[model samples]
Target chain A: MIKQLILIGLLGILFGVFFVSMQDIQELYNTFGKDYIAATGFADTGSRNLVTAILLDYRLFDSLFEAGILLIAVSGVIWISKHESQEKNAQFMLDKFKTPDLFVTFSRLVYPLMLAFGFYVIINGHVSPGGGFQGGAIIATAILILYYIDADKDTNIALIVTIEKILYIAILLVASLSLVSRGELFTNFFVIDASPDTKAIYLVLLNVMIGMKVALGLWTIFTAFLKEGR
Target chain B: MNPLLTFVVILIGFYGLSTSSNIIKSVFCVTIIESGVILLFLNLGNLDGGVIPIIGDALPVGGIADPLPQALMITTIVIGSTVTALALMLCIKVFHHYGTVEWAEILSRESGK
Candidate 1:
């Protein structure tokens, strides 16, 4: 009881600081908090979507590390949850349930649409609100739908892993090529001071690679969890 | 433009975290906090009377909200959800091992070792 009280008191104090700090924050538009980069975002990045420009072009390094973090976390989960009972339980799960035809039909109907929409989002990341992460998540959901349709059959995990590796390596290759071209990494090498067509192509390529890597990585993680139980 | 609402939500999340002993509830509290923080960030970027920051001939140059915070929040939301999912997975593993997910019970079981 004492410990709980202490926790509450500590939280109250912390929130008090937040409440006090909020008062000082004026409306962002009236103050100097204007997004100055957004003013020239299209000129600099050739992306109509300012958020995508900030994400892929300005802060590409951070996004790469975020993807890496997800990889590490999923790997950790797979590593820690290993047990003999889990294998048996997963096998039991496979043997117990029959796939409903309705679910199968529904998934078949919607899965292709989701896949196409995901690709469209990744392809048009620069032109629209959707980007690599969002598109990848959608594709991952589509993979999840595929999983639901046929849980008994195991897809080629090795192939997915290989594709994920190739995509990551491609991203690295692009980054290194940019480094070589401009003496700095992720320099928007083809975008800045380049023609319109190549700039659009470069951004699209980056977004596509990131999208594929993210989708494959997430699908692998989900399957790893599904294959094991506990 | 009011940050007070988001702050209140964050405080509620903190309170939930402080009170909860269940691992699942803890995950929920963390998610609530993450959502509150995201809301706060989106609010920070929003102008008092502004539009989305998409650029085109139809959209005006001025009155656009800050794009940086919204962009950062996008990645932040993804990362937060992934972390919460993993945490819940770990909690399941713990529950399977110890037959309980309450922190006090888990602690007692570990201490018995």
Candidate 2:
């Protein structure tokens, strides 16, 4: 009985804390009013979306670091797969497509549309909510569907290699351009105001490159797992 | 509904994390938990009547939703995706190494060694 009371008491206190926190947030909003944006100078960056400004400009170094992370992950996966390839082959069954013909045809019809949608999202990321990461996942979904449909066929290793090369080249180009335009090399150079058109072009190009890279990288990793798990 | 729903989601995620035996399931639970935190943050930062946090001559005089939290959430989402991917990869590695995904079996086998 004593333990039950203690539990109830704890729950009540937690509820009280939550209520107070919400009230505090509301109070803070009341206090700040419109002065918050005026003080931030976010609109001056030429990006209408405040979130985009922060992501592509304000904390660009962090974004570059994230790209580095993708590189490291891809390299690590490659290393691990190479080490375990021989072991994986003996146990793996590369041919396992037991689905109906109708399902395969449906997936084939949907795959191209999905890929196009992914590309659209990547291209329009600067002006919208969907960005490289979201689009890349969508693209990977398309590739995965293809892989499932054609399990017996030789995997499209060339597609993955091409995407990887393109991404590396694009990253290098962007990084170099940022370095040259601004003395602060690793800063978010894409936001620098040469022209609105130029910035938009660069943003779209970077998004597409990153999207392709992530999609291919994820596809490779998943295929490696499927091969090993079989 | 009230923002309390966010807390409920968090609790559900915690329950999932604590009870799940499969490594992959636990990783997904962690993603759910992270998403709950993101939702909570977004809710906390939202103003009752506000506009997007962008400065212009046409700006409103009323409250403006906090841009900082939105920015933080984007960063959090990216980090969360990477972490979840790495966790799944780790689970795959564990499965490859031990031939089983149950934490108990793996632990017992390691202990016996």
Candidate 3:
């Protein structure tokens, strides 16, 4: 009886706290106002979107390092999986898991559309709501769906790895170019006077690379898990 | 609503963090809590009588809505998805190793192993 009472009391308090917190959301708007836009407008980067300015300029280093982190994680997963004992023979495992006909047909039908949409999001990230990370993740989602549905399909691990490598190299090149343009070695470059066309090109390129890398990385990781399961 | 509601979400998230025994459930709770913060941010950027930030005839000349929040939201959304995927992968690994998804049981088993 005492325990039940205490639980009830806790629940009541939790709900009360939740209710109170929800009431305070309005204050945040009052404080920030249009300052967010104003700040972005003053930034050295040429991107019109403040968020883009912040991401590609003010916080470019963080973004670069974040990509590095993903690289490390991918490398770690590959290293770990490579050493694990190969359960049942590869051929046997492959044979046991047949790709469903419906899944194969659907994937074939949808893959091109998914890829096109993903590219569109990546390219238009600068002017619109979407960006490289979001677009990349969407692409990754499509690849993941394909992987999940086609269990018996033989994946070209080497090809995936190659694509990931190329993308990483391309990103590094873009980052390097940005740094060079700013005359800062190993530093973030926010070129304020650059033409909109240049910014769009760089942003779109970055998105496409990120999309490719993320999709491949995820596919590789899933493949490792499937191997582990077998 | 108001900042108070954001706080409420945080509090609820904390409660879930403290009480939930399932790892996946706890991850979800944390996500919910993060979402509360995101909501606070979005609310912060909103202005009275503002139009959508998009260019052209849809928006009035003077009333441009805040664009920063939308961009931030996009970043947050991507980060959230990545975190969720990573957490799910971690959960799967935990399940594979311990044959259970409950936090306490997994910990006990790990200790034994």
Which DockQ values do the candidates obtain, in the order shown?
A: 0.60, 0.35, 0.32
Highest-DockQ candidate: 1
What stretches of model 3 exceed 4 Å from their correct place? A1-50, A76-83, A88-104, A156-166, A184-191, A228-230, B47-49, B52-73, B96-99, B106-113
Clashing pairs in 2: none
What does candidate 2's lDDT look like per residue over A1-230, in tens digits?
67556655665676578777776664455535225444543443455456555556666566656766665675565555555235544223435437688988999999999999998887777666666767888898888788667764445544675677677667667756777667666545654556555566656666677777778767766665565556
Ranked candidates, highest lDDT first: 1, 2, 3
Q: What digit string (tens of lDDT, one per residue) describes model 2 on residues B1-113? A: 35787877776676667667788888888988898999988776664646766544455577467766776676566556655656776777788899999978998999999
lDDT of each: 0.77, 0.67, 0.64
**What TM-score does each of the candidates earn?**
0.89, 0.76, 0.73
Error of 2 at B13 (Å): 2.1
State the lDDT of candidate 1 residue by residue for A1-230, as single tens digits.
89878887887788788777766766323534445565667777788888888887787787777877766665665566555453443332544677788989999999999999999999999887898888999999998888677776575555877777777877878866777676778657773687655677878988898888888877877776776641
lDDT of 3 by residue, A1-230 (tens): 67556765886787777667556645644525454444444334445555555566555566666666666566655655564554543232544667678877888788778877887877776666566776777777677666555555566666777777778877777777755677764323446576656555666666567666766776766665565555
